[model samples]
Target: MADEMFRAPVNRSMRTLDRNSFRKVIPLHAARVPENKNISKVRSELERSKDALHQDRLGSVFPDPDRDRAKSGTKCVLLRPGRRKEATETGDNPHDGAEVTSPPLYSSVLDALLEQNIIDLVPYSLYLDYSYWTYHDIISAILPEDELGEVPSGFSQVGHVAHLNLRDEYLKYKHLVGEVLIDKNPGVRTVINKIDDVGEENAFRTFRYEVLAGPDDLNVEISEEGCTFKFDYSKVYWNSRLNTEHRRLVSTFKEGEAICDVMAGIGPFAIPAGRKNIFVWANDLNPDSYTSLQDAIKRNKVTSYVQPFNEDGRSFIQDSAASLLTTTQT
Candidate 1:
């Protein structure tokens, strides 16, 4: 039988059997053959076939184990595979939920491809899109007209940017200048040229004065509306923008309505609101603004309506529920 001959040892000189005869004899010795005989060779060939199939699925002639998701050790971010390319090209959400697209070709994929790429693979440098802005004066001062654009943009022009770059300027006259400007005159008004340099697409702004010149003391008193206030001078200067907005808000209040200015600064709005016959409670975090606010309140002669607070805004507001209500006994 063919199975018996196969187990016996294949001899080259043995007579060849026809296909039909070989098939007939295979069943005669089938029970004698061991189960574990050819499993290793079969598994190796099957793995080769699977690799080829996986490569083909990725549309490659040669199987690349790295780029092929099947061979990846990292967890597959299960997605509808074909839709990835389509979604990337169109910038549309593929998953139909709150799905967000990652940066094109994430670094993890790039790293895997780098490790698994075929022969003659050379790494490519990453390219980034950026815009740099600078003052024309600074750039012109740095280099000759012929050498223009050779130097980097001199300084950042954007306002309130976290990271900033300032180009080196050739300061030939600065050898003797160490802390030269001593009298930082806060009273001096700033001119436009001194404050900002006009540039393409951006304008820089700077403050002229010491920007903080106010009293430093905390004064607490109950306003006619029975609310406490504490003013801080340093906070008032730093938060100057809030002053204008507070002024606008105070203008909207109706006459005789009790209003509380929690976190008030130097009586910018509270004192002015009191002058308009509105009962005001002015409170501040800084002790200085509190004393100044109280003095300003007395100076303005609005003692009857404007009160001052020395405690935190939370405590004052928490304790002011009854005093805040203007309801009449029915």
Candidate 2:
């Protein structure tokens, strides 16, 4: 039942799995200790799981603001180890032992954003480098070296993802997969290489959806509508400046005027005005963002008054410039 509920996303070509009959146990062949001679199989299994892992994360890595502030514009962000360390008063082994601490993501983005210091510049996700945990490190932690060829440890293999919804909780179960490492779903799983030149597969096998901090995670309640979409830092834009500029331009247009935005990111001003039955032409430079605007238009069902354009905003307009006939023809 648990496996069914946590089943991998649907795949188009792979055989449809019987939700009930699916078994996740390691094969007896797999259990046989992999001898140096069987290293090839070990490599294949590692590659398969690794590929599946990449498919799991769709590749959105956001950066952190707090850490961005600490580094003096340096590329290095001081990451607290996964385990906290305790030191003895005596100099010998002064650093008694270390316990896992929160994982530190790479500081390149945090550093870059801080250095730029642009308003509305946000990091919706973060990418982490966890390649340090090699296959050897993973295998050693999961099995005694001698057992590497015979059979992998029961719950100590290199590539099983425990479905823990929360980040910290996921970290707790990290050892089951060999190491306690955290990385952006995409960066950790390089799907292209993992697929080994095979055509792309639909759905991911290991991506876990987690709300690190939000209305409930932060202990705050927000209106249902506000909490629907996951807030990504990269989605933050400098709308305040544009809003002011838009207002200034539109102020002179009297009560009824046609408005068009070459680059409408979220339709913030476009939707509200369009609701008043004003004609609006909203477009976006990015396909994903344009799709989002299109969705917003559909959700609001403002298609009656709002027109969408998906092509390059400038080119689309220039081509239509001569044919644009805004006034009603008698």
Identify the candidate with maximal TM-score. Answer: 1
Residues 53-162, candidate 1: write the lDDT tens digits.
12111221221223442244211111111112224333366566565454432233323323443121222121111111112322333334544554432221111111
Compared with the true structure, what per-residue lDDT tens digits does model 2 show for residues 1-330? 322322323322222222222222211111111123433442344334331112132221112234643243312111211222344234345486644444333233333433543212222222222332233333333443444363322221111121222223223323333222222232121111011111223111112233221121211111111211112212312222244565555444433556667766556556555656666777766555566567667766677766777778778677433332453111
The alpha-carbon root-mean-square deviation between model 1 and the true structure, to one decimal in Å, is 29.9
- Model 2 scores a TM of 0.28
- Judge candidate 2 against the unseen true structure and give its global Cα lDDT, from 0 to 1: 0.35
The lDDT values for all models are 0.37, 0.35
The lDDT, on a scale of 0 to 1, for candidate 1 is 0.37
